[model samples]
Target: MARFLPAIGLWGGLALVLVAVNLLIVEKQRVLDDGRTVLLALRPVDPRSLIQGDYMELRYHEALVPADAAADTASPETDGRVVVALDADGVATFRRFDDGGPLAADEQRLRYKRRAPSGLQPDPENSELFIGAESFLFQEGHAEAYEEARYGILKVAPDGSSVLAGLADSGRRPIRP
Candidate 1:
């Protein structure tokens, strides 16, 4: 009986792990396939050597929260969510830091994890917010092509959980391998 118990534990553990991994993969695919698409500008990146072999590292402009009206009064909590509203051009802009408040019809809530506080309080020139999917490593050796990318294509879920799917050029076309 004891010998049987050990085998059962081992198999059970492996089964649980596999189930968790499968669920995560399924959720990610769902986001990529059905989530809302938003285009975010890329903060200027040095193109000199952005490409390494095949994949390129990506950074997005939307990841930084601008010190707009709502940002100024919000508390500096790294583990909270933020509501964003799209500008006329479909660019996501910070509407307010999450405060458990009501949102405007156009606003979408995005979960945020603040990096070390910038110390620079919310102001016109220099505040930033750290949203997830800040960096992406794509296939390598395509540096020159991706260097011209100015936007990051993000698939944002209804709850504001977002992922950087790929990079895009000024024309908003996906920069594929």
Candidate 2:
């Protein structure tokens, strides 16, 4: 009975892992298809791993909700929802439609679901940005992932909407797009 119990536990754990991995793969593809393409300046981090697999860490130049803007109610509750509007200069600016701030100069937009606990204030010296999503915060090696991410404006949607979809490079289109 004891030996059987151990085997059952192992198999159960393995099954659970497989299911979780499959879900991640599906979501990855989904984000690729529908998620916004954020072009960020990538800062690579040391790579390491355990049960799942090894992955590169990344940080972004365009990750934060501009510290100056954070004070404004336009900043959604952590991980709430933000529409990233691009200016003619191609800079990506964020605002919550609910908050009703005027859109930036450009009509291009991207959507990012708010992440809680907030992220770091924008520091010019460091081009790194934070992901406020709970999943990003607690994943096993996510710290490294965020540390190495390349930051850039993913893409611009019409009518003040953003893609807020995934973590990867976007097709380049200057800053405003």
Candidate 3:
């Protein structure tokens, strides 16, 4: 029975790890599938954490949420929503206002609340759009090959929710984040 119990525990742990991996893969795919393209102007975050290595902080030009929209939908504390639109140059543009109307039928919304409570305080300095994706801050310098080749793609839904989607491949063509 003791031997059997160890084997069972090992199998259970293995199964849990597999499940976690699968979930991450699913999420990556889902973000890629649902995300749209928006040009996030690089603010270039300074390199900090001597132990962590070098990386840049990113600040987007198009970060904001209109007061009207903020009132209607629950805002995430870590991040805020911006209306993503296509610019004349065929690149994406974002506005804090909901001028784009609604997120497409197929589009999905991602909120940025690490814990419960749902609402986040909007940073007046950065405007209404707070940090929607905490993943970005951590992602700096972790993978230069991945970062250099990849571009920032944002996936947004009808209610003004959003997620940061990384470019799938080098072409910088939008695939998923």
User: Of the candidates shown, which would achieve the greatest lDDT relative to the real structure?
Assistant: 1
> Per-residue lDDT of 1-177 in model 1, one digit per residue for the tens?
987998999999999999999999999889899987777777866533433434444555644466463245445564668777876655676667767777776777777654444564444234455666656565555667777788777888987787778878888788876
Global Cα RMSD, each model: 4.4, 9.7, 7.2
C-alpha lDDT of all candidate models, in order: 0.69, 0.44, 0.47
TM-score of each: 0.77, 0.43, 0.49
Model 3: worst 10 consecutive residues (lDDT sum)? 108-117
lDDT of 3 by residue, 13-126 (tens): 999999999998777666557655444443334445566554434443333323454444344334433444455422444434333356643333334322323344443323
Show how many residue pairs clash in every candidate, following the order shown: 9, 36, 7
lDDT score at residue 154, model 1, on the 0-100 scale: 80
Q: Output the better candidate (1/3) by TM-score.
A: 1
What overall lDDT, based on C-alpha atoms, would model 2 receive against the true structure?
A: 0.44
- Ranking of all predicted structures according to lDDT, beginning with the best and ending with the worst: 1, 3, 2
1 or 3, greater by lDDT: 1
